[model samples]
Target: MVKQTNVKNRKLICDKLLTFQTQLEADYSDKLYEVSRKRYAQIDDLENVHTGFKSAVKREVKSLIPFSDIYKETIKLSFERVDAQYQKVEREYKEIWKEYSDNLSLNWSILAPAVEGMATFCGKVMRVLTSSNEEIDVSKLKSILYLKELNL
Candidate 1:
């Protein structure tokens, strides 16, 4: 009886852990999609606005005398802003991935042994159920059997 209760508790914990893990994965995926969409939008805006301006400047500088030092410095500063934005996006993505991996590792470590033990206990229960010559309580056996099937 105590063994049966332990198995039921382990199965419950495993199911809850698995559900939490699935929810975390879904949240992470949604966050990644949002970040990717925003990144693409930023890239598109840069291409539409800055690319045309840069091309016009290059063409004017080529046809005319030359680019002023101020123009060159302004372009460099614009590029620096782009670089900073890229770095910020990369860091945010890295942090998200780290959090996802840490959560996954912790959940898996806790749930793996519990799941394995539950399986072992179920196997033992099955052996006893099938091999015993005496009659058993069918309701109790069915309840325990249902508990064994609660995967995630």
Candidate 2:
């Protein structure tokens, strides 16, 4: 009778653990999906901002920069800085996804790092972009060339 009770208790514990694991997996997967979707949308908006900035620069800077060597260099440096900012964000985004996928299991708590990294990455791109604009602005460049308003 004791042996039967021990086996039943073990079975009950195992069943409870399995249920918890299943729920955790579902919850983690849902959270990841939702966050990734929002991040992707943000990336799309960033791309649009980049496109608009590029178009404005091409149209405005091309005609303006020829007159001032300092302005030309400033614009070039600004473009490079913006590109680097984009690459950093992209790298962090990929790293989070890779980390999640590689350690995927019942460990939903592991997502804290990924989620925090995601949250921290937010607004950084724009910050970099706008700071670059400051340098451009000092050169007396057009305000239209700056990413003053984010699409988001």
Candidate 3:
């Protein structure tokens, strides 16, 4: 009877462990998806900002014929707008890094064995963003990606 009870308890523990593993995997996968989506959105925003800046530069050049204090002011404002957009992008990158860092910190205990897996996921994401064919350059985004890719 004691042997049967021990077997039953072992089975219960095994089942619980399996459930925990599954949940952990799902959580990590969800995080990866979220990060990928956010990265893509940031890329889109960067493209839009680049396009707008180019257009503003073209406009300024065309208005050189009517160069005046007003035109100069308009150019100055456009430049400032571009600066603001770059700053916003920088802020967003930092936010994403923080989010990933927080999530990893939260799950560290439960995901110790899966640390390498998580790092691989992050590395793949970085590769996708840094690829030459990628629409947006993310070379500067490597630090955040690498940190998240660390084997916890």
| Best-performing candidate as measured by lDDT | 2
- What lDDT tens digits, residue by residue, belong to model 1 across residues 1-152? 99999788666654543443343234333333443554223333333333343344334323332335533543354345444554565677669768865776555776888887996787567545533233222222222233234332
The whole-model lDDT of each prediction reads 0.44, 0.47, 0.47
Badly placed stretches (over 4 Å) of model 3 are: 1-52, 59-65, 105-152
**Which candidate, 1 or 2, has the higher TM-score?**
2
- Cand. 3 TM to true fold: 0.35
Arrange candidates by lDDT, highest first: which order? 2, 3, 1
Q: Per-residue lDDT tens digits of candidate 2, residues 26-125?
A: 4333323443355334444445545444455545544543435434554565566555655666677778768977886666677968876886676675
lDDT for 17 in candidate 3 is: 35
Best by TM-score: 2
Alpha-carbon shift of residue 79 in model 2 (angstroms) = 0.7
Model 2 misplacement above 4 A: 1-48, 62-68, 106-152
Who is ahead in lDDT, 1 or 3? Answer: 3
Model 2 lDDT-worst window of ten: 143-152
> Which model, 2 or 3, shows the larger TM-score?
2
